[model samples]
Target: MKANPGSAAGSPTPVVEAKPCGNTGETVTERALRLRVRQQEILAELGVRALRGTPYPELLEYAVQCTAEGLEAEFCKVMEYVPAENRLLLRAGVGWEPHLVGTASVGADLASPAGFALRTGKPVISNHLENEERFRTPELLVEHGIRRAMNVILQGEGRPYGVLEVDSRSPGEFGEQDIAFLQGVANLLGMAIERQRIERDLRAMVEEREVLLREVNHRVKNSLQLVASMLSLQANATDKPDVRHELREAATRINAIGRAHQRLYRSNDVRVIDLAAYLVDLCADLNAAWPEGEVVARTPDEPVPIATDRAIPLALVVNELVTNATKYAYPGRQDGLVEVCLDQAPEESRVVLAVRDAGVGLPPGFAPHASTGLGMRIVTAFAQQLKAELRIRPLDVGTEFSLVISLQAPDRAG
Candidate 1:
């Protein structure tokens, strides 16, 4: 606790005068002992009240009033340290003029009682402000007729937060007990102030972390898009049909993943993706890339939120299947129709994704497990990663590929 510059020995302005025991005829010494005990009891109760979760300002105000009432001082105040301003700001007070509670500030120099206590980490006591020589008398105290004062530093974690002080219009000496009681009140007040500071810091950290995460996702999306652009440029420049086809295909795959990252960056929650929006955007990109086929996606009215780890693989599976249908499903037509459907099972924990084409079905004697084609292999691998079953059915005039993903899997499909 901080020190007070003034001594505690002097006459007191009678804020509250000690009265004789009624009809008991008790000795002066006994009466003084009883009064001291009662004072301790009041301080103890106020200490408990201070520990409650009341607003800091209200509680601090109550604490100062309690100090004044308990010690029979006419005035009391709590001041908070502002290091940047190098001043002690009055946070709460009792018996001060109304304008002074929020407006008063004192220099945090050796001349001020609050500053003296903060510097020395000890209690300061003054019996007569008029005769005090340890520190210059503050004008506010003199204006209010304060003659006696005691102050203690409000310290937390061994660092001073501010000061708690009680003053009187009368002059009198303050005993060691008075100083000790004020110190106790300061200790309790310090704890509350510390708790608020820590909470504010934690909230700031959480907000900062969210901002950083979004920035990382945004940068990643931009970088991936750059790579996709490079692949497109390379594909357009190549003269070999097969090499150009491979590069375009690579670019589409990179662009598909980039779409997912971009969506997450724009979303409020980074941990989950709205799969419906994701599929629509993916299909739109595919239609533009492969204008020979018209790609369309259908989804439910409510949002379909998928975990981050699962959304990427799910999007890729759809991309590969739809691209294959556009390439091989329609042989003679310039514009084939490919439909992608996403639905949640009505009675089971599963998602069913179906991609269908309105053109000639798969070639005769085709087998999914034995197919050496890259598209077929990729579809099968993604199906296994999602812990879903893959099925291909030949339509009367086209082909359909379906995957039923298990939502309860221990780990998300690849």
Candidate 2:
């Protein structure tokens, strides 16, 4: 959750007043008790709201940066925890250019608050930046004309999640009270970040499940093809010619159905056909099976993405038409031509698949309702399945069949 709500210009005008508590004659123990009470009130309010109401995604970053900059500090920054790396990374900061805004990370160690917080699961404070001996690089603040800073650890689920830091260009900017208040803000930020990470992981899991289910469907399609092949072998070994012919046609159509899944199953694309690639392979197989005539295939340069429902029927329709072109369209002629072409239709919603043949035109009378041939029925069924318009026209030299169905990107639907 690298959600930096604070603008680059700096946090919005703070509503709270900023002041310094002059060091009086109070004992160190008394002063610490008062500062701890202030921290308690801030944390209690934060906890109440988080438990009672919905929180905005950017609220945590907003509060951290706003509170720090509101304290009239010279430089302020917040670092979010990266659990995978077991480190706190700088996410947002003021008084720095774009280069320094998302700078780097600080692993858990004595010098960095992120490191100390993870070790103790509590906030760490540096009362003075200029006179502190623990810091090896005091020039970091002197170079930027900033002298003081404070660090607060954000705890989520009892683990350190990040740190809230406030710095000033002057030598003595933050006191003990300021440190305590920022620590409360850091605690709120940690809880919000933890919640956001969980939601993100859940969303990724859901998408992964969808992909797995699609893979399972693809596998089922392959199994169906194996079943069809087994029946084909049984038919070939039988003596009855009539049974053999019916079984043979059934096997062919079933294989055509299987081919659709076979292609889709092998691809990572769950819904979309490399219709161009699919047609090329389908035509090659048909050519080998019925090589008496020449069948030429063509497709669009761009890819066409059709969902499962539309893709299955579209592939089978092409299968039946091409199979027929090989069988009957070139009657008594060994040297005819079958050409397949695919192109994006007008309106960009449909793709046109056209199969043309240089052979005798459609048989004398091929009425859909009266035709009993398996090939004609297959074409009609698939056309209806794809919600496509199937047109058969008599050309000057031969016949042409065109199937048009609207195309949609897989992202738009299943």
Best by lDDT: 1
TM-score of 1: 0.73
Please provide, for model 1 over 1-414, each residue's C-alpha lDDT reduced to its tens digit, 9 standing for 90 to 100: 133343332223232234445688887568667767767887777667656666777888788888887787889999888999888888899998778877898888878887888887867877677888778788778888888788889987657898999999864556566777788788878887787677778979877877787888899999999999999999999999999989998888998999999998888788888888899999999998988668999987778888887889888889899888888888776788999999887647678889999888887898887899897888888888877789888888788899887644445364
lDDT of 1 at 319: 86
- TM for candidate 2 is 0.62
Q: Tens digits of per-residue lDDT for model 2 on 86-145?
A: 666667776655475566666655565446655655444454445556543333445676
- Local distance difference test, per candidate? 0.81, 0.65
Candidate 1 contains a number of clashing pairs equal to: 26
Ten-residue region with minimum lDDT total, candidate 1: 8-17
Going through the candidates in the order shown, the clash numbers are 26, 4
Candidate 2 lDDT at 105 equals 62
Q: Score residue 168 of candidate 2 by CA lDDT.
A: 72
* TM-score per model over all chains: 0.73, 0.62
